[model samples]
Target: MIEAYQKLWPNRASVKNIRTQQELEQQILIELNDELTHPRVRKSKEEKLALAFSRIEQSDLTKQQKKDLVSLYKKIAAQ
Candidate 1:
């Protein structure tokens, strides 16, 4: 998780220099709050999935195609 944060916010000094478990937890909480409250941060996986499903619903794809796509998504998620 630290590695992911480092990759996402390489400029964040706290993320780059975590030295203890407590500090890591604190940094994670701070970053998580930032992610939740900041509009410009990337959306969570569930949000992105919901957006994709919504787009699929709005698209002009055939019903069977949509069903197939959803089934494929479900299968992938199951793994």
Candidate 2:
């Protein structure tokens, strides 16, 4: 991967232009979609929710509080 990127950016000694923010974001979304939908990544809704909940919990929130916040955010996002 690194070699491929370096090949694509031979002139970029810093490689700063190897991936723009928009490109990186699009790639991230693509990876997230794949991870979210892949059975190997998440076998069930519970597994998906657990992965999300874990991320929320890591963000300075208690387990129950994270769940509540995630629910609230989902509601707001849906609207």
TM-scores for all predictions: 0.44, 0.30
In candidate 2, what are the lDDT values of residues 1-79, reduced to their tens digit? 2333233335644444435644533333333344536567544434444554456666554556555645743443343
Clash number by candidate, in order: 0, 0
Give lDDT per model, in order.
0.54, 0.45
| Candidate 2 collision pairs | none
The weakest ten consecutive residues by lDDT in model 2 span 1-10
Q: Where is model 1 poorest over a 10-residue stretch in terms of lDDT? A: 1-10
Local error of candidate 2 at residue 46 (angstroms): 0.8
lDDT (10s digit) by residue, model 1, range 39-77: 777665455446546655776666766666555444433
